[model samples]
Target chain A: MIKFLESIGTNILSWIKITQGFLSLVGQTFYWIFFGFRKKRPLKQEPILDQMVFMGARSIIIVFFVTFFTGIVLAMQSAQQLSKLGGTIYVASLVSISICRELGPVLTALVIAGRIGAAITAEIGSMQVNEQIEALDTMAINPVRFLVVPKVVALFFMLPCLTVIGDLSGMLGGYIIGVNNLGINSHLYIQTAFEYLTLKDIYTGLSKSLVFALIIAFVGCYQGLNTRGGAVGVGRATTISVVTSFILIIVADCFVTGIYYFTNL
Target chain B: MREHKVAISVQNLVKFFDGRKVLDGISLEVYQGETFVIMGGSGCGKSTLLRHMTGAMKPESGKIFFGDKDLTTLNSDETEAVKRRFGMCFQSAALLDYLNVEENVSLPLREHTTLDPKIIRILVKMKLNLVGLSGFENLMPSMLSGGMKKRVGLARAISMDPEAVFYDEPTAGLDPIVCAVVDKLILDLNKKLLLTSVVVTHNMESVFRIADRVAMLHKGRVLQIGTPEEIKNSQDPIVQQFINGRLEGPINFAENIDDVNFAGEG
Candidate 1:
């Protein structure tokens, strides 16, 4: 009984420590992004541009495919139910609203969590094990400013952009199914989709993506910087980073959705 | 060598790893413009000692001084200020794989200075030339041989023209010919640049070849400190066992065997 209680206590303490590490990382990333210029190590622009190209531009195709396919599936499934009520035209509203309000942001964030988040963790974890991070430190280069800031800044700006792309591709997928398979008029379908997609829905999804960007970047970088034991450690950190980002993205999405739902935003 | 002005001094450093003393009450001083080698068998805490002196790891209870400033007492920014004045060459070379050779060598200069890009390029070329890697600027780290990678790392380390350079096993996994080349480079850099160098290695030949003075570390304590010739002729059995690379002597193999597995080194 004593041993079990002691284990629980240790686990709680460690969890607190991990939380502290994560919050501080987030705090430091923001600090470097905003105020780092006044210090000796001003945030560099070249790395941020490089990271934007890698994390944002390279991810465009994958995000489009995932959300596009999801839109097709949603249209097909919802049409079956709507046709029975003689409201098959409402499929346009259903698909567009769902995509813009939930699937678009959430699915895009998930895909990036798997792709870019895993890459960040693996890259940084390898550096940690390889002593490249230490080499940077000995050179007086702040790894956070040099590494984490670029990634966070790039992803923060890019995830929302990808989410927007994901949103459009998804609507296009819905439009294809609604016009051809379901025999709905293309003009009417486009009109219905836009008519129901309020500014609130679009902005809510974007705001969720902003939160998710922070989550994915932070989780990936935190896992990476804390990695140990070498190659095996890098692999483990990548896996954990991806899994943790997935969970946090979903959890944060739920919280944001609940806030909107309750506040009528 | 140059009036015995101390560049780095460690006083009664104590560190613990998982409750075991990794660095015990240890102390040493490295003189300016001298190649001071810390030689030890595996797990003797030579690497750990080097880390503390480089300000990479903080001792649980001790102070490290670079010149007059107490490293352990400095804040993060202050520590970084001190770090800018020194360089470290890691064992694995530790070059960023994403960057090309010229970019890697110029990392510190770009980070710390607002120098013109053309001037930075010239400095990179000069440093790489010093390590005999000029004209190989566009090649990535993956394209380099083990020895070339170390040379690139050396170029990067000295790119800033630091006051001191700390080398963690500078020639651990090289052929003897490459080892001699690296030793010569160290000697040339020290003599030509008058750079203070602190080297931690177990390679006896390189230790004797490069060290102006040598400190023998055993079981997290300094067993002896002398000129390389004196260390070579040391009367201490543990020192003898280490320098001779013998399997039998006062130095026990059992305790150090765990370190190999612990550090995941072969």
Candidate 2:
């Protein structure tokens, strides 16, 4: 029907509008980071440091736990199949390579998307509803410079760092399973985990995490700054932020992995 | 009375929300060193008009001038420069809840100036003292009572010694005694700091207590503009309905309640 087509058209138009809004927000955040201080005031270091501690330092344990358990599961699943081929020792290599190339970065990002991403949305959404953001605007304070920049910068550097920790913890988990449960020699397991795991796997995972960091920060902040209503609005924004970040993280992971696959890297 | 110079002028400002005319051909002026109150029922576009004047919201048509500068055409930097000349206090007090009182008051000075920290501290103390909140500097906004929060908000508003301060329902939710105290503070600040004040409120008591002039808006249009006494004696039925807090007359309650819900959508 004509009405159905019209509704579809309206949905597409709203999708385009939202995309434009999101890009503009990301653009403004970058502009503030690069050139805002030169023209106006330099951003204070204190807020950025505070954000780094919260987003990076505090997230280490959760990232470790998630990736570590994932490594154990991946090892257990692979060991069952490899034992049939009489290559049960291959469990160490399989766990290390998969964890470093995929699970470590992806799991860490998903966990952070839920944790810090939700927090970012909640904090900024509350500020938006309470009119503190407008208060800053009336005071000639750029909210992007005052708020988003610190968060973006913190996560930009911190997500990779967290990914590194995730990678190590996951490898440790694999080592424990391969040596103790799988009956593989401890020394041989260590050697096998490193032998097939090239520098490419580590760098690829870290690079993917870098991109994921931008996705999480941008989605969280966009949802936050656009939030209306009051407490309910904040809750809605947080949920949407987390969901959007999760989808984007998976989609981005696919694209990045595809790039490496196609380019034969 | 001596001739007064205009501090802010809005000419034929129009705005729409969800295709509804929320601010329609509104015009007004606030004079320097005087308390000009915009009084109206909820959803009458008084707050929207104040937002335009503060340059927080843009109008679809017409110009807003602060002294000689037109607000609509300014670049971001120019707009920021213009904003630095005035202050706004929100209905919720809108203090940065993360910051302590002294830090909140000193935010502007720290961000905008190269002043010594000691000097900024002294200025914060003085501004807080002016609002009778000197000793409450270390307390967070959450620790303050409603009246004290409003006072802290007022202190933050005048922290930069702005030429004008716009108050959005400064006494919206408070005991009547506290409301009177806030009104008195507005009067004292006007006299003491020689600052222009534009207040938007529906509270008739505060309007008479502090206003040098009053503009009553009804359904996105100015119903009447006059001194408090003239407004009190206005012949317009809508104005009479508003000033007397009556449920009957030209203003419709069901319609306004609908407008309130619609306003939320935009």
Candidate 3:
């Protein structure tokens, strides 16, 4: 029992450190974009484009599928629950607001955190096991620029785009479920959804999604870039990257939502 | 003896991990245009010492100088600038798996220079040809054998026309014939290009074939530094133990590296 407790405690602390590491990358990236562009290492444009395609553009299909199904399920379940209050008609308010301001961004980030996070860890870990990162160092190229930055930038931009698409699709899915399954009026649903979703809420969701993007990419790449001990280390880092990012994204969603509510109130 | 200018000077290099010393106090002066080999058994910190010299990792306590410049005190940018003058072949070839061979070879030139693509391609081809890998430029790293990957790595290392090149365990996983080819390529690179070379390896065969000077690392400190003939004929019991393939002497093998594996010509 003692050993198990100790391991759990250790795991929690490690998870915190991993979160802090991802935050540090965010801080550094902000610093670079604003005040330290020259000091920030120069990135090779070609490889960065390749990474963006993989981490962002190439992931569209999965992102769309997950978002659409998630929206439908939430509508179906929430409509059933709200019927208790004679509020089955409020399905539009629930689905649109949740999809626009919360569920859409959160679920999209989670899906990507699982997808790109695993990929970044595995790709970097494989390169690490194969000595490719070391090779970059020896060749005098910055690994942060060559590997991490591209993914970070890609995630920074692409996550928001993915979220936008996800949010729209999810609301559309809810609209379908509301009209076809729940027998809610189609015109009223769309009107109420737009009425509930303000630009401030939409912008907040988009901005928060960007932060989640940075967290996922940075954690995945950092763990992989710093990986040691070859194959086992690579595998361990990949698993940690995924778990860490997943937990962090969820925690971040709560925090961002809390801040958004209080600030916008 | 010709007065060889010092290219890289390492002194009092002490490093440890988890209370165990990896590189004790290693001191050496590498001269320009020489193939200097740091020969040691597995885990003697040959690569660690090389990383320190390259400024990839900071030493716990030590000083490394490239000429008169103190590399230890320099920041990342300064370290990168210093690194630009040198090329490195990683132990695993370290090719960008995402890139085909031509793109991999073109990496350094692209990073450092704004030359025309045509010129970069020509130069990439030249470097690849220097390693006798002419038509293999379009292949991915995964498509190449261990030897071919190593060759491509070597070609990429020389792409920047760097003043010095570092090879980390260059011949470890390859067959004996391929190892000879790598050794010859190193020798040729030094001779034909007049480039300074630092090779980290345990292959005595490679050392004998290529090194202008051989340095043996034992228990972190350099146990011996001399020409191949001097290392072979030295009276130092540790050098003798290592070179003679005898386990009974002062040299202790890492745990589980049985004596039978090391028994052979020094």
Candidate 4:
């Protein structure tokens, strides 16, 4: 019994050692490059296309269009409240700054993280519980490099691109409500939006998206890789991935934005 | 089968899981060009033994020999280099969902060979044909039937022309005809490639059909090693009960069901 505990401890420490080794290696070099890396097992592509389709392409209409209405509501409410202060015209600046600088990236990432990150977790968790990861290991493949690296590659790249698109769509919606119907003068609305949305504001929001992307990928993959039991475990992993990523995103958003301000870095 | 030489050897192997000794001091030998069978019920440490043999899991003590290479003493890179000379097919098939039948079959080849995709495609076609999956090159695992999935898995296993292969429950859960087909493939592969094979299976029919020699494990210990007929005639009650599929035996079900001892069950 004591020996078994000792072995488990050794396994964990050895696993840590292996992880450090892998992280240190630069892109695509292997000790067996000449001999052919036969231990490559199977490169676990982990449903990236399906995830992107559901999380990226399919959600495009809902994310951009739904948030478009959110932007319009923000503009109209800001206009009404500012009108009471005799500052209705500046509402354009307020709506654009808030939507463009904060609401756009964080909101879009949260929504996608809910949809896509949960799917990644559930799918991977199911695989894990089913002995799929062990099955992969038997074939001598590194499950992390196989299952994880690709998602890290895909989500890290895609979220930033999606954030840019979400912001443009949101601002367009605000313009439609603020100028076309609200009679705020379309030219002045545009001028005020440009003036209010500084480079710093844009960088802060997009920066948050990049960080949120890391959280979603890591949390989803970690919970999945550690999942035990069966289908119920998969369910728990998905739920945890969504809830955890959502909470972490909000908290990290505040912290990152605060860091930008406190150190002014 | 022709008389064969040493393919793999295990000496004084020991392993533990969750603070319990699962694979107690063990020793074995596998000769080349033979289907060496390891039989044990779930949790007897058959899979664990296989994992240690293949480098997926390391032993707590003792050594493993792949043609006298002393695999247990080797470093990670050294073990990997030796592992390339072998292939494994898992119980669940473990087909990559994103890959098609051709891509999955060609994976080991691509990983182990510098052949261009064009040549690799031809080799894949040949392998698929060998496994009776000639037209399934473009079909994903989700599109495959259970039997077809196993065939594709077999194709993938042989893709590298490995000197040896390990099959974990190869005929498990398949219908009789499918099981027969799997058995035939095992026989045919050994005949054609002269590859040493180690298979862990509980099915008696598969044991009789494919195994040249069988090792029966009981309670984390190997109780017998013999030919199918020898095993059948033996008076070892555990082997007799297992072979006949008798419900009553030393294997107490609900009594030792792991959960029975836990407080959470209530």
Candidate 5:
């Protein structure tokens, strides 16, 4: 009984330490961002541009395909029930609102969490294990400003752009299903989709993506910089980064959707 | 050599990891313009002491003075400024894998200077040439063999002509021929550039070949610090045993065996 209690206590303490370290990293990231702006010379632009290309442009095709199929599935499932009640026209509203406000942001983030998050963790974790990060430090380069800031900035700006593309693709997929397969009038389907999806819904989703971007970048970088051991450690950090980013994305989505729902209510 | 001014002065430094002391109140001085080698068995904290000296790791309770400025009292930015004066070659070379050889060597110059690209290219070529890698500029780090990677690492370390260079086991995995070549390179560079060097290694041959003075660390403490001749002729059993690679001495390999047996029993 005493041994089991000790184990629990140790695990809890370890969790507290990890949480504290993660929060400190978040704070430091923000500090560097603000301090760079204050100095009238923001962080370097070259690395940010490089990261934008990697995270944004390279990820578009995957995001589009996934979200498109998701929209098709969502419309197909909803149309069955709606058609039973002779209300097939409402499929446009359901698909548009759901895709624009929720599915678009959440699914895009999940894809990025798996793709870019793993890459960031692996790259930075390898650097950490091999002492390249220390070499940067010894050369008077702030690893956070030089490495993490560019990634954070790139993700912050690019996730929303990807989410917008996903939203469009999803709506288009729904249009194809609603008009062709569900026998709804093309004109009426298009009108119903736009009428229901207010700019506010789109704004809510895009804004939520910004928060998700922060979680992915921060968690990936935190796991990477703290990686120990060697190659095995890098692999572990990469896995943990993806898992943590996914969990945070889901949890943040809930809080964001809840707050939006209640405030509007 | 004994009358020369100190380049780095470490005083009463102490460090702990996981409640175990890794550096225990050690004091030493490295003279200007000489190769100071710290020799020890593995896990004896030579690398830890070197890290502390380079300001990469902070000691629990101590002061590290580089020239007159106390490194322990400096802020992060100040510490970074100080670090610009030193270059370090990691045991694994630690070359950035994404960059080609020329870019890797030119990194410090790119970060710290606004030199023209042509000038940077010229400097990169010159440094590479110094390390006998002038034609290997476009090669990635993965393309290089272990010896070549260490040479490239050395090229990058000296690209900025730093006032001091710290080498962490420069010949740890090299064959004897390559090790001898690296040792000769170190000697040539030290003489040509008149740079202060601090090398941490367990390689006995490297110690005698390159050291102007040797500091032997044993169990987180300075066992002795003297000229190589003095160290070789010293009466300390631990130093003699370590230098000679003897199996029987005050330092017991049997204790490690006993620990293994005890753990197996448990």
Candidate 6:
């Protein structure tokens, strides 16, 4: 019983240490973001642009395909139920509101969490293990400002942009299904989707994406910078970064959604 | 003999990792314009001492003075100001894989100075030429062999014309011929540039060939510090065992020995 208690205590301490370290990393990132411009050598613009192209532009096709297909599936499922109740026209309201307010942002974040989060961890973890990060430091370069800032800035702008694209693709997919397959009038389906999707819903999804962007960048860079034990350690860090980003995205989605729900009430 | 001036001095330095002392009460001085080598077995805190000296790692209780300024007491910006005068070559070369050779060598210049692109290119070429890699400017780090990578790392290290260069096991994995070449390059560069050098290596041949003075670290303490000849003639059993590769001495190798039977499997 004593041994088990000790094990549990150790586990709890480990968790606390990890949480503290993670919070410290997040705090440092924000500090650098707000004050880094005042430094004698401001953050460079070229790397930020490069990262924007790499993380944002490269991800559009995948986000479009996934969200489009998701919309199709959602429309088909909802149409079957609504048609049973002689209310097939209501499919527009269901698909538009759900896709615009929830699925668009949430699914885009999950996909990016897997794709970009893993890549960031792997790249930075490899640099950490191989001492490239230290090399940067020896040359008087702030690794956070040089590396993490560009990634965070890029993702901050791109996640929302990608979410917007995903929203449009999803709505288009729903339109195809509602008008062609469900036998709903094309004009009525389009009008209903636009009418129900308030600017509030669109902005809420975009705002959630922004928070998700921060979570993904912070977690990925944190896991990466702390990686040790060489190649195997980098692989582990990458996996952990993706998993943590996924969990945080879902949790953050819930909290943010809850805030919006209660605030509007 | 040249009159000695202290370039770096460490006083009563102590460091602990995981509740175990990795550097214990270490004190030493590296003279200006001489190659100071720290020699020790693996895990004897040679690299740790180097890290501390370079301001890469902080000691628990100690002072590191680079010239008159105390390194441990400096703020981040001040420390970076001090570090700009120093160059370090990691054991694995640690080249940024995304960059080509010329870009890698030109990184410090680009980050620290606003030199003309033409001048940066010229300086890159000169540094690469010094390392015998002039024509290999555009090659990626992945394309280079182990020896080439180390040479490229050296090229990058010296690209800034630093006052001192710290090498961490520069010849760790190279063949004997390549190791000799690297040693010769270190000697030539030290003499030509008059740059202070601090190297951490266990390669006995490297120590004798390149080190102006050798500091032997044993179990996180300075076992001995002397010239190569003095170290060779010293009476310390541990030093003798390490320098001579002896099996029996105060140093224990039994824990690392395997118990496999080499005879017929009776």
Recovered fraction of real interface contacts per model = 0.97, 0.90, 0.94, 0.32, 0.90, 0.68
The C-alpha stretches of model 6 lying farther than 4 A from their native spots are A1-5, B255-266
> How many Å off is the CA of B145 in candidate 1?
0.7
lDDT of 2 by residue, B1-266 (tens): 34889999999999998789999999988899999999988788989999999999999999999999999989999999999999888899999999999999999888888999999999999998899887888999999999998898898899889999999999999999999999999999999999999999999999999999999998899989999999988899888888898898887878888878865764
Scoring only the second chain, what is candidate 3's TM-score? Answer: 0.93
After superposing candidate 2 on the true structure, give the runs of residues whose Cα lies further than 4 Å from its correct spot.
none
Off by over 4 Å in 1: B1-3, B261-266
DockQ of each two-chain model: 0.92, 0.92, 0.76, 0.36, 0.86, 0.74
Over 4 Å off, model 4: A1-58, B1-4, B69-74, B253-266
- Give lDDT tens digits, candidate 3, residues B1-266: 35999999998998876566777888999999998999876666788899888887788887999877789998877887888888888888889988999999999888778899999999999999999999997899888999999999999999989889999889989999999999999998888899999999887788899989999987678988899999999989877777667768665545426422322100
Give a tens-digit lDDT track for model 1, residues B1-266: 54799989999999888777878799888888899999888777888898898888999998899989999999998998899899899999999999999999999998888999999999998998899987999999999999999999999999999999999999999999999999999999998889999999999999989999999987778889999989888899888888898889886678668776544532
Give the per-residue lDDT of model 2 (tens digit) for A19-114. Answer: 999999999988888887678666678999999999999999999999888888888889899999999999999999998999999999999999
Per-residue lDDT tens digits for candidate 5, residues B1-266, read 77899999999999987767778899999999999999987677788898898898889999999888789999987887788888898899999999999999999998878799999999999999888887999999999999999999999999889889999999999999999999998988899888899999989999999999999998789999999999999999999999999999988986546434332221
Model 4 per-residue lDDT at B72: 77
Residue A167 of candidate 5: its Cα lDDT? Answer: 95
Clash counts per candidate, in order, are: 0, 0, 2, 0, 0, 0
Poorest stretch of ten by lDDT in candidate 3 chain B: B257-266
Ten residues in a row with the worst lDDT in model 1 chain A? A37-46
lDDT tens digits by residue: candidate 1, A1-265: 9999999999999999999999999899889988987785566788899999999999999999999999999999999999999999999999999999999999999999999999999999999999999999889888898999999999999999999999999999999999999999989999999999899999999999999999999999999999998899999999999999999999999999999999986
For each candidate, the alpha-carbon lDDT, in order, equals 0.92, 0.92, 0.84, 0.79, 0.91, 0.90
- What's the residue-level lDDT of A124 in candidate 4? 80
lDDT assessment of candidate 5: 0.91
Predictions: Cα RMSD each: 1.4, 1.2, 3.9, 5.5, 2.8, 4.0
Q: Tell me the TM-score of each prediction against the true structure.
A: 0.98, 0.98, 0.91, 0.86, 0.96, 0.96
Note the residue pairs that clash in candidate 3. B24-B220, B243-B266
Docking class of 2: high
